[model samples]
Structure formats: C-alpha cells, structure tokens
Target: MDAPPDIHSLLAVLDRDEWFSSCASDLKLALVRDARLLRCLAGEAVYRDGESARHALFCVVEGAVRFSSALHDGSPSLLVYLEPCHWFGDISLIDGSPYIRDAIADVDSQILCIPMQSFTQWLDQNPKHWRDIARLSTNKLRVAYQVIGEPGALHHRLARRLWLMAHGFGSRMQNPSLQLSVSQEHLAQMMGSTRQSINAALARLEGLGLLVQGYRSIELCNLENLVNHANRLGGE
Candidate 1:
C-alpha cells in the first residue's frame, strides 16, 4: 500500500514542471488554492471521448493517464501516457469544445482538478494570463506533432518513444527518472505496430545495452545512446 500524496510533494513536482516552474507565485497560488485532488483507480475513465464539455483544468500528480481514441470501426487507439506534473484538458478548456480524446487512468492515480468557473472569473479580470493557459495546450501540441511526424524504422521509432517517455515528452524535468511504466502492448498501440514487432525491437534495444525490459515497464539504460541510435538509424 502506497501513501497518499501531500501538498508539499505536489508543489515539489509542480516546481519541476516546465510551465508551472515559470509561473508567478500569485499565479501558482491562484491555480492551486481552489483545486481539489481526485483519486482514480486503475482502468477508470477520467473523461471519455465526445463527451459534453465539463470545463476544468487537470494536472496529474501521481501514476499515469492514457490518452486514447477510437478508430472508424470503433476500435480503441492508445495515443500516449502522461505522467506526474503533466497538465491536460487544456485543448477543450481553451476552445470551449468537447474533449476529443478519452483520458483514462492507466493506474491508480491522484489528479488535481481546478474548475473552469474559478479560472473563468479570474481570467475575466486577468485576460493576459490566458496566454499561460495556451502555453499548456501548445506545448502538448508540439509533442504531438513530433510523435506523428517521427520517421524511421520500427526500431528507431521505438527508441525515440522510449527516450521521449523517459523525459516526459520534452517537458524537461529537473530530474527525470529513466523508468517507464508501460507494457509492450501499450507501446505497440502508441507506435502503430504489432506487439510481436515491438517485442523484437525491445530485444534489439536490450542487446545494444540501451534499455532493459521488465514486466509492464522499461528502464532506459542509456538515454544518449538511445537517442543517437534513433537519429542514426531513423532515416531523414
């Protein structure tokens, strides 16, 4: 049994986050003061695709959230997993549109929910701060573009994905843990490759001393080497 997250620990994680770290103390307080922490068990839906808009901001404080969607035939498609200190629900928050993807808990997780009403009142007074909110969505959009446009062989793509996940998809944490909590099946879904193919790629990476695969997890042994391999083998 793990202990529940405390405010002190939560603040520490926010300090490491790229966007939150740069925010003014008042802005940070404004966001955190009225927030409520919600605990979601594994395999739960934080929010589903095409659901009516419930405007709120969210920050993952513990565990991971899976962003997924459905195919034409209604098959599920896993996009990526977001870890601690990652903010989401911004796209819908910005445009006032319904959520486009399903946000599901990949594990038992703690998430901070800030109602839009509170922020809406604040933003009405401080409209300039809307840019800060935009930054959150745009930062994620940048990562999405990188992932979608990533080119190369399956092995190369896998290496880059491992590196990106370890680094929080370019969020640049002060201290990034190299361990990734995701199964090969999830990886296959993310990379649009078969699970067997992902297994082979993982074996190749493991043989190269780049990573070690565990049960539902992967430990990046050499981040630099992994990126190098991806760029070298990942053709232009």
Candidate 2:
C-alpha cells in the first residue's frame, strides 16, 4: 500500500470538507492550528470505551477507523467504520459528554485530533459554523437510525454500508475500490450479526463476482452492481 498522505495537505482538504465549508475562515484556521496529527498501526486503539472525551473531532486523513461500543459483558460491538474526509467524536465534543464509543485503527491510519476546548472556543467565536455542525449531526443521527431499524440479513446491511463507504472514500480515488482490511468478526459486530453470517454474506458476494476476498483485504470487483444491491436491500 502507498504511504499515507502528508498531514498538512490532508488538513487542507479537510478544511474544505463539505461539513467545514460553512465555517468562518478564522475558525477554520484556528482549528487547523490546534489539530494534532497522529498515526496508528492496524488494531491500535485510538481511544477506548469509557475513556474521557477530551479529544474533540477526529478527521480521518488516511486509512480507516472503527468506532464501536462495549457490551456490559465487555465484548466490543462495532458501530461503524469511518474513512478519509469523514469524522467522528463530534457529538461528545459539542455536548461535553464522555465518549460513548471506542475508536480503533482498522489499518495504518493518519488522523487529525482537535482538542474540545479549542473547538468550542472557535465555535463560540464563529456562530455560522453552528448550522453546518447541526446539519452534520443530523445526518449522523439519520444513518444511526437506519442501521438500528434494520438488523436482519447480513448481506443487506453490508451492502448498504459498502455503498455509504464508497460514496465517502471512493469518490476521490481514480479507480475507487471499496476494499476493507477488517475481519469478519468486526463486520459482524457492525451489522449486528454473527461472524458466520458475515462469512456467508461474503461468500455470496464473491460468488456473484462483486467482491474478491483476500487474507487482509476485500477488493470490490463491480462497484455499480454492489451499489445496486445496496439500493435494493436498503429500499432506496
């Protein structure tokens, strides 16, 4: 795999991110100044469940992060996989609440961490960004609701998620591939199913020639067909 992009260039792209376009120039500049760039190898914990929500928003510069929550029995359940240009931890940052989920690097990942205090101060000074922030929050809530409302077939959920992921990350790639480096267990947790189910679904997709599964990655063979499957499953 190619080396991750430089943090400064990544930040420049993120600053012009759709979610940040409405933000004031000064506020955006301040955020860029306050952000800390960090890298983590695959499987490293960016933040554990129940950890203090001191780190504000995290913008994925390269690779992916898996956001998950722990069960009462301490088993982790995956919530979602966030990729480049997408962000996480904004809810905790804005509300002054504890992080409700853990964020783990699913691959060698680069991220920009913004401190909550600085984010809040910048927001206070630039009220215009509040509307954009609210829109972003609402969009997240809608996605969460969709995921929760449909907990049935594994293939169905995976299809929808793949579509979303492709739209978020693949739009920028010259030959976009919805390849994922995570395990079946993590995928099952995110889909609210068992590993067996995820395995079965992957087999089915492979049989359809929609995906090519490898030891460490899954290469999307037919992106359009996969998206069509998602649309059908999601009732879109």
Candidate 3:
C-alpha cells in the first residue's frame, strides 16, 4: 500500500477535481487550507448508516470507499464505490441529516474531510457557494439515474458499470483508468445478479477482448470498444 497522503498532495488532487475546479478561488483556498486527511484501513467504516452526520464534506483522495445500505432482508447491499477525486457525504451535509448509507473503506484509503463548520461558515459568508454543493449531490443522482435507466442485457449493463467505475462515475477524467479494484461478487451485488451470471457476463467481455479479469480486479483492454459496446443502442 502507498503511504498516507499529505495536505499538499491532497490540495493538488482537489485542484484538479471537477467539483473543486468549479468553486470560487477563495472557497477553493479555504477548502484546501481547512481540509483534514483521514486514513482508514480496509473494511473500516468511515460512517455508518443512520449515524449522525459528521457534518462535513468528504472526498476520496486515494484508494476507494464503498457506499452501502441494508436491504429489506437485513443484508447489506453495495450502492457504489467512490474512487479518487470523488466527493461524497454532501447530501447529509447539505440537509443537516444523518447519513443514509454506510461509507466504508474498501481498501486502505486516504480521505480528505472538510469540517461542516468550515463549510457552513464559508456558505454563510457567500451563500452562492451552496450551488456547488447542490451540484455535487445532483451529479451523483444523475449518475444513479443513468445506471438505473440503462436498457440492455447483463453484459451491456456490466460494460457501462465498468466504464463508470473506471471514470469515477462523473469524474470527467481525460484518461479513464484501465484497472478496477472490484471483484465479480461486488459486481454481482451492484447489478443485483448472481455470481454465476456475473461470471458469464465477464466471460462474454473477455471473449471480445475487452477486458482481462484478475484475481479480484479487472483490466480494461480496449476502452474504445468497451464504450462502443456499452453505448450500442440495439441488443447484441
């Protein structure tokens, strides 16, 4: 694992992040200066479902965090993974409510947290900045809607989900990531399908030379082709 990231490195990441890039210069400075770094071990819960909000905004600086909620059967369901440069916890921060899902470190992770007090103070000073936070929440909702609204067979859906993960949802990364630290089981959970079905879907992609599955990871071999497959309007 990599060493914990320092504030300077965190600032560099925030400077390039989509949401932070849109903030006013002064607000950006405040966020970079006031942010605190949190290091979490694998499987550690950063925040639990129904827990009182930390009243802070969070961004994954390094590694990944999983957002999950329990199903009606009392089983935990995987909502999504937040990778580097992805901001979360904004919904609770915006509405002054408890977190609706659990945020856990999927692996050893470095998280940047800007305390709610600092956020509130900044917003109070310039209420217009609230729009930035609203954009954060809405962006996530838009991605979720896209995923839920995708029309296709399992393979098509899987392709889109993989593409989304590699891009950190709506990260707008110039070069999308080639590797994903996700297991077939996690993919199955995300798709609400069985492991056997996920395995079959992965096999289909593999056959098309789109990806290569590792022990618990997947490497995209042809992002262009995969994206084409994902966006294809007709059934395959």
Candidate 4:
C-alpha cells in the first residue's frame, strides 16, 4: 500500500493529461474535488481480474502500470505497459464488467481515481467520449485479430510491437533519443511469442542499427527506421 496524494498535487497531475484536458469544465471540477490519489509500490497489484472494488477510472500520474492477464495454465500473460498520463479502466465504465486483466504497478506510482458515477455523469454530458472508447476497442480488437490470424514470422511482429511501444509509451529525450522501459519477456508476451523469440527479435533489430538494448529497456537510435519497419510489416 502507498500514501494518498493531496488535492494540490493531484490537480497538478490532472492538468497535463490529455484525457483530463478533453473533459468538460464541470466534469473537471467534480473529478478534482472527488478523485482519490492512490499510491502503489513496485510489483503491487492495483486491481486484479474478477474482483469488485469501488467503481472508478484510473489515470497514472507518475511511474507505470503493467496491464496483463493469465494464461490457460494460470501463468501470467503480459499485455501492455502504460506510462504516466495514460488512462485506463474505461472498459468497466463502458459495460459495468469485471476487469479482464490485472493492473500492476511497474514502479512506485501515483494514480488518480474517480468514482464510476462521477465518470458516468461526465460522460453523460460528453457522450462524444464514446467515440474515443470505440476507437480504443477497435485498436485492441485489431491487435487480437493479428495474433489470431498471423501467428508466424514473429520477428516482424516484434519490430512492429517495438515501434508502437516506443511511439506510444516511450518519451523522447533532449538527446533526441527515444526509448521504452520494458522487459524482453514482457514484450514477448505482448506479441504472443516466447522470451527467446523476443531476444531474437531484439538481436535482429540491433543488428540492423535501429536500437540499442539494455537490461529492461531499449533506446531507439533511429525512430524513422522503426516507423518504416512497422509500416512495412503493418499487415502483420
């Protein structure tokens, strides 16, 4: 367990989030007034699949959360790692459904949580928000379809996955470098491949002069190359 954030700090974090920016002014005030700041330490579960809690949406304010599920044998399956300012939990909001995956902190983290009712009130006035939700669902479905339809030639898939991770979750630094803080095994699971497969893919990418890999991370040396690789393998 972690300490809760005070109103001032929470408001500061919400100010930078794109989702919060899109919110109506009244909705923003309600969230700022009512949202709880939750602190989760590294490796702690924020929420698990198949459990009920106070209904709320979560936005990471600092650190990262790894969203994952389980395998048929009850082993863990890594899905996606969300970075700070990323929004999650709307699946529950959309259908009042239980979480299908676990949201675990990748590091000591703070997140803003707003009650489901408050979220609904906001969405009611901002029904256009549904379109954003639909786009998210469609993208996930597209990923699932790729996994189901094209199971081989995994190195290509790995390249595309890395491209997406860098573009989405990673940040560009002053050195003009882009990198993702992730484990090879986690990346492997996200691509529905094995750890060995992930290693091979990284080796391939490194050989191509696209990135430099380190423990639990990879720095993109040439982002345009990564983007072009993803596009070339886009159909994968």
Q: Which tens-of-lDDT digit does each residue in 1-236 have in candidate 4?
A: 23445766666666565445555665566665667778889998889988774555787888889988888998778888887676678777778888768899999988778777866777788887666555545555664564455433566667666665654432211123276788888887787778997898788879988889998989888877875765575454
RMSD of 2: 4.5
RMSD of each: 2.9, 4.5, 2.6, 4.1
Go through the candidates in order and give each one's C-alpha lDDT.
0.82, 0.72, 0.83, 0.70
Q: How do the residues 162-185 of candidate 2 rate in per-residue lDDT, one tens digit apiece?
A: 655555532233334476666788
lDDT of 1 by residue, 1-236 (tens): 23434656677778878888887776787777677778899998888889766656888888899999877978668898899888888877787888888899999998888778887788779888888888877787887887887878889988988888888875664567689999988898888878999999999889989998889999999888998999885253
Residue pairs with backbone atoms closer than 3 Å in model 1 (clashes)? none
- What local lDDT does model 4 show for residue 1? 27
lDDT of 3 at 66: 89
lDDT digits (tens) for residues 18-122 of candidate 3: 777777887776675666778899999888889888657888888899888878988668889888888888888888899888899999998887778877887
For candidate 2, the 10 contiguous residues with the lowest summed lDDT are 168-177
Q: How accurate is candidate 4 locally (lDDT)?
A: 0.70
Backbone clash pairs in model 2 (N, Cα, C under 3 Å; residues 3+ apart or in different chains), count: 0
Model 4: which residue pairs collide? Answer: none
TM-score of 4: 0.79
The best-first sequence of candidates by lDDT reads 3, 1, 2, 4
**Model 1 Cα displacement at 35 (Å)?**
0.7
